[model samples]
Target: MPLRLVKRLARDWFLLGMLCAVVLAVLFPEFGASGGPMHADVVADVGIFAVFLLHGLGLPAAQLRAGVVTWRVHVVVQTFTFVVFPLLWWLGDAAVGRWLPSDVSLGLLYLCAVPSTISSSVAMTGAARGNVPAAIFNASLSSLLGIVLTPLIIGLFASATGQSLSMGEAVLKLATLLLLPLALGQLLRPLVGAWFARYRPYTNAFDRAMILLLVYASFCDSIASGAFSKYGAQVLGLAFLGAVLLLAIVLALTTRVARGLGFSKEDEIAVVFCGSKKTLASGVPMARLLFGANPALGLIVLPLMFYHQAQLLVCSLLAERYARRPAPPPGA
Candidate 1:
């Protein structure tokens, strides 16, 4: 490869690194699996807490309040997050649940149930010159809502699919791993929120690091337990395709809905970005708490990892296209 080409490809170094990390974990399960001298499971727990703490501290109380004031846009965005996305996944479950292990379909549904992303969705909205306030509100609210809604949605799916889980235990784990630290961050936000804001770039990187670690841990455990063998390339490949289809269907639907609702161009951009994407940062940790013990956890999350990458590429291009268009003639 040409030197410039190599560097250009490396522009998305983090995504490439994430793919390589999963591959290495799949091949060397022992390094990531629990019950080792390094105690990966313990480290993962601490990392999860830190990730959400940053979430709480970094969120802006002013933006959140402003978001609530514009409840009209949020109603559509939140509806897509909690309702439209899950309904599509539920349809997928009905259509293909019997074909794969319950874990595979359940994970897809779990990803759907998780909230819209806080960072990328908001940033992309800002890039497209959309409603930044609405983006921030919907994404932040979705994360908080997912703390409870995700587990409940999973519990409902488990009941339907004959998958057994101790809901009480799962909810408790979420409260601890996901919610408590978030609450602490919010509480302490008043004390040191400015400091957290100053270190935004580092804190964002820290969030990604924690997610990568959690993903690595899941794949390690899954591979260590022979989970990949159960899900051959044929099945995993199909899941990736399904994730693409899922995003396409969502994009198409959100665009049509946004237009039909007669939303302004900016509001449509916010709706499309905030409504269509899922939060890997939230999904990965939730997967750890909800499906950590399941051997097929790795396979379950495989679709989500692919879906996350796919959305980022598609949305970036779409946002840029929107940005390039001429602005409305100063409100006509």
Candidate 2:
């Protein structure tokens, strides 16, 4: 393509980083696989904990203290995040399971069960001149809710499929690897929150680095275990298409619902971004804990890997479009 277009595409740095990570994983899986020299899982767990700790530190205390009293907005965003998306995916699985590999289907279902993203949702909301505070609140709330909810949703899914779930184990993993660190960070926020918030850009970059490490390590383990061997080019393409279709459906639904509910333009933007995005940062760790060396993990996370990149590109374009809109007449 043209130079400018390449640069534009490259602006989604994390997306590009993820692509590079995949290649490295495929070629040199030993470093990140189980019992590898690097102790990848332990490192990833620490990174996740630290990233969320910074998230807790950097969060705007006043906004969170005010809380999500906008029950209408919170209800809609959380419902779509935790309920509508998963329900649709479950129904889709029933209707389309015959067409998809069982592993891919389960992965898609798991993708549906995760939380809304954190930084990107808020960042995109700000770029689009949306209600940034509301986006932050909703996205953070969704992450916290996901700690409790993703496991439950997946447990129900496993139960319905007559699959076993180690719920206690999953819960413990989440608490240690995700929640406790965040709680500790929040507790210490009084002491360091200001500094973290002042250097927010740097902290956010660190968070992205941790995410890249986690994604790379997980894919490395899967590749090492031959988890990707069953997926041919055709299967990979199908997973990509499935993820795109799901993202489109959620985007369209959120847009229509926000408009129909008579939300202001700003709130609509928050709804569109927060309600439609999913967190790769949270999903990878949760999958590791849930699946625990299941060889199908590479396939299970395939849809999410595709969907995460797709959402970044799609939302960036939408944010640009929103930025270009004429401003409303001041004070009407």
Candidate 1 regions off by >4 Å?
1-9, 330-332
Q: Estimate each model's TM-score.
A: 0.93, 0.93
Candidate 2 lands at a TM-score of 0.93
Please write out the lDDT profile of model 2 over residues 1-332, one tens digit for every residue.
Answer: 25644677778788888888889899999997777988976886678778778866766668865546666777889999999998988888788777877777778888899999988899999999998878989999999999989988888886544356678988888888778877888899999887877897888888888877777777787788776776667768878988999999999999999999999888899999999999887787777767756666667788998999889878888998898988889996
Q: Give every collision pair in model 1.
A: none
RMSD of 2: 2.1
Clashing residue pairs in candidate 2 (N, C-alpha, C atoms within 3 angstroms): none
- lDDT per residue as tens, model 1, 1-332: 25644554468756876887788887778888887555777988898889888988878889888778767689998899888888887887788777766667766777788889989999999999898988998899999998888778777767656676778998899899888998999899999988888888888888888888888888888888887776667767766887899999999988899999999888899899999989888888888888777877787788888888888888887888899988877758
lDDT of each: 0.83, 0.83
The C-alpha stretches of model 2 lying farther than 4 A from their native spots are: 1-6, 159-163
